[model samples]
Target: LILMLVMVGLLSLILGMGLPTTANYIVVSSLMAGVVVELGAQSGLIVPLIAVHLFVFYFGIMADVTPPVGLASFAAAAVSGGDAIKTGFVAFFYSLRTVALPFVFIFNTDLLLIDVTWVQGILVFITASIAILVFTAGTMGWFLTKSRVYESVALVLIAFMLFRPDFVMDRIQPPFQQVEPSAFTEALGNAAEGDEIRLVVSGPDFDTGDNKETTLVLSVGAGSGEERLANFGLLLLPEDGVVKMDEPSFGSAFSDSLSSFDFYGDDPVQIASVQAPSNQMAKEWVFIPALIFLAFIAFLQRARISRQGVPA
Candidate 1:
């Protein structure tokens, strides 16, 4: 996933070079966004459409700093009396310091402030600001003063942990338990009120008539199994011990997608897997250890600064 995204970013950068902002955005969005969306689905990743577009946009804008055709670099060179190509190369390397941000937010949409409460947004902003600063310090090889090689590496790791606390938590405990499609009702009933259940369904596409699978995260409200499914515009019928989709109710959330499904046809739509959210500790708990590690690095840097009589 990371390598594919990196390639997409590089492609966006190359395609966007020398283009104006609006044109660059249009080109990347039209050409690259769908590629990302397709890649994400193939990887079983539920990437938000907005995230994919923003990812392309971020890299597209980086073209301004890239070498050879960087218009912004040419402008900067005119003002600073530097070589245009050299300035662009330097700027491009500097821009790479924050390059990980787009990738970070792609996997962690909360960083984009999507679907977050005001308090959560504020916390995200604060932590994101600190993480960026630490990341910059790490990459630039200076915090209080020049850093040791190990300190720089540790700083980068700490910054990553701060940016993606859940990465560690996910490794420790998988986020979801996959349930069989036939047993989706049982899983839905077992979930707590208002919790999310990820449903995977495969069916023919409405536009292209090609077979495609999509993932939907439905909120399971307090109700019986049938009622909960009805709330999401899904009606299931059991035939020979296998559950099949029925025509969705009018104007319901799943109407558009479910409407195309032919329950009785040879290639009828079917539920693939139902993922129930697992019980795990809050991801924020990881911040504690990350901060502790940051403090340790800070202490070491401070000691170096004291020994060298360097001003912090």
Candidate 2:
């Protein structure tokens, strides 16, 4: 999956060089994601999927601002007669923020709308925007009083928080806390409600062998006594046909024969739940090494600046 995604991104970037944004998305999504789907990855996660596609898309466009075939820089140089390589470098640096944005959205689903709440959605937009601003400052070495080393470090830290919304950051140093009285308060209030609701298993099917196998379906609900707004069926499977209901008070009760086996094993089941955290975390693990690498670059840049006595 990882290799496939990377290939999609690389293909998109290479194909999208000098293409407009809309054309890039259309071409890549039409070509790249189709190939991925044919290979069996779910299409529902297409947003992040396309985000990955766009990561390479933007980088491909950025090649126009880089050397050798730097079309945009070449055009600008033709008008000004400045050094083409220097012009390309300047253009690339000036446009670096645009190049970095698609990667952020690809890694952070809040930006791409995966399991995002209203408040969380808002925080993501605000923080991401601010992160872009900070990135601009860091790249240009201009912010409140021409950002110094510590200030650059602070900007990078803030950008990290903004780029990735993790539970650890929420608990310790929430940037959204200072937004407004209602923002954080409402988010906490919703958090108290807990977005995920657990549904208890009930009834039995004749497919089990000894009836010792128990089946339970976990679902989201309004509250303890309220009817479930959505149905996310069975969490487990029973080897036997008999099972007792433990928590009938949770959601609607149903008893039916197990569906035919198809996708997984001899018995097939349809899953309607949101993407699991384990899966998400695993996917996100790909970005950790990349993040560490970027952080190292920042650290090296800071050290170099310090040595030169330049305001970082």
Collision count for each candidate, in order:
0, 7
Error of 2 at 231 (Å): 6.2
TM-scores of the models, in the order given: 0.86, 0.48
Candidate of highest lDDT: 1
Clashes of 1: 0
The root-mean-square deviation over C-alpha atoms between each candidate and the true structure, in angstroms, is 3.0, 12.0
> What global local distance difference test value does model 2 have?
0.49
How well does candidate 1 score on lDDT at residue 21? Answer: 98
Please give the TM-score that candidate 2 achieves against the real structure: 0.48
Query: What residue runs in model 1 are displaced by over 4 Å at the alpha carbon?
Result: 202-213, 235-269, 308-311
Off by over 4 Å in 2: 1-9, 18-22, 34-57, 112-125, 140-142, 145-151, 167-237, 240-312
